[model samples]
Target: MTEQKTPPPPQIWPTLRAADARALIRFLVTAFGFEETVTYGDGDRVDHCQLSWPPGGGLMLGSVRDETDDAWALQPGTFGAYVVTDEPDKLAERARAAGAVIVKEPFDTDYGSRDFAARDPEGNLWAFGTYRGEPR
Candidate 1:
């Protein structure tokens, strides 16, 4: 397989903080087809959770400790996730219905993609697009 980004530690972990981490995980799994790989927490309070996709890649989720630890903190329009999908429009719609804030409307790009962007609840931006490059 072609190497990309040093290959994750068997996973491409992106941190996510939500009011309901479980719900978010459920939504990701059920709606987006992610599988719960490893979850670490207590009493429904998740300190850290891992979710993996079938083909490859995984996302990391955790609880926000509202003290001095700002790692889990999210600011308005601050986070971003670039996801390549066969149907950008559909994914954007799903994201919108799932309460994601649509940042940029779908449009064609000179870089070779028809894409759109959305911001998740924790301020992370998710981008959907088909970036087809010229054959090497």
Candidate 2:
């Protein structure tokens, strides 16, 4: 048998700001199966958080702040990301059960990917699919 190598941890993190960071975090965890790895800040203001996708990548996020308060002024509800998954159908079902808005049902892409799109409670667009992206 051939040996397999473990992939390195993700270095590039997709980040977003949420108006209701705590609730958004909960929704992401419950609706999409993102693991809540770490969270900072007190009360409802999430200064920083890392939600790890079980499949080997993760994302960073924080509470929204005014432009004057934070240099990264990413607006809530304006973020979008595509997540790779092996089971888009089951994931979509789970998302729907958790009340995620289905923007697009599972479909086959021309390039041979099974994908589906949904909107998070914060209005961020999340596409889950079987595409692992082109080899680097």
Candidate 3:
């Protein structure tokens, strides 16, 4: 009998565009506790940026391009993400201190998770929560 081999899981990373990529990078670091891994661009013009959250996870971003006709064209705030955190309240406090727009204060859900929602400087929605979803 032959043994079947399982394929590796796909790698998915959320990509976003920011009006002020430099400022956005700083905001993400100060507020969301993301550490910069790599950034490409000169001066304030960021062509691409990558950040790593402590322990695990990462995100990619870049400055909004002027090309409007391309399929990759996207506006600031077009993307939203839900980040898993061990401490939602602490994260919320840090985000608030860094001037993130708090759309919803930290609250407990009936499903037994603590969560909060906030908007980035460019208006992208971010939800931090303890919930990891259900396993199949």
Best by TM-score: 2
Off by over 4 Å in 1: 1-11, 30-33, 66-78, 132-136
Across residues 1-136, which tens digit of lDDT does each residue of candidate 1 receive? Answer: 6645442433356666666677777766654456899988887677889888555666788665574667557533344676657787887777677776788988999887999987665566677687633333
Model 2 scores worst on lDDT over the 10 consecutive residues at: 1-10
**TM-scores for all predictions:** 0.67, 0.91, 0.87
Candidate 3's displacement at residue 91, Å, is 0.8
Q: Write out the backbone clash pairs for model 1.
A: 79-125, 80-125, 81-125
Which has the better lDDT: candidate 2, or candidate 3?
2
> Cα RMSD for candidate 2?
3.3
Query: Distance (Å) between predicted and true CA of 68, model 3?
Result: 4.6
Put down candidate 3 lDDT per residue, 22-95, tens digits, no spaces: 99999999999999999999988888798987756688998888876546687898889988789999999999
Error of 1 at 80 (Å): 1.7
lDDT of 3 at 49: 90
Comparing 1 and 2 on TM-score, the stronger one: 2
Superposing all C-alpha atoms, what RMSD in Å does each candidate have to the true structure?
A: 4.6, 3.3, 4.0
Task: Supply candidate 2's per-residue lDDT for 129.
Answer: 97
> Per-prediction count of colliding residue pairs?
3, 0, 0
- Give the number of the best model, judged by lDDT: 2
| Displacement of the residue 51 alpha carbon in candidate 3, Å | 0.9
Predicted candidate 2 versus true structure: per-residue lDDT over 25-105, tens digit per residue: 999999999999999999999999999999778899999997997989999999999998999999999999999999999
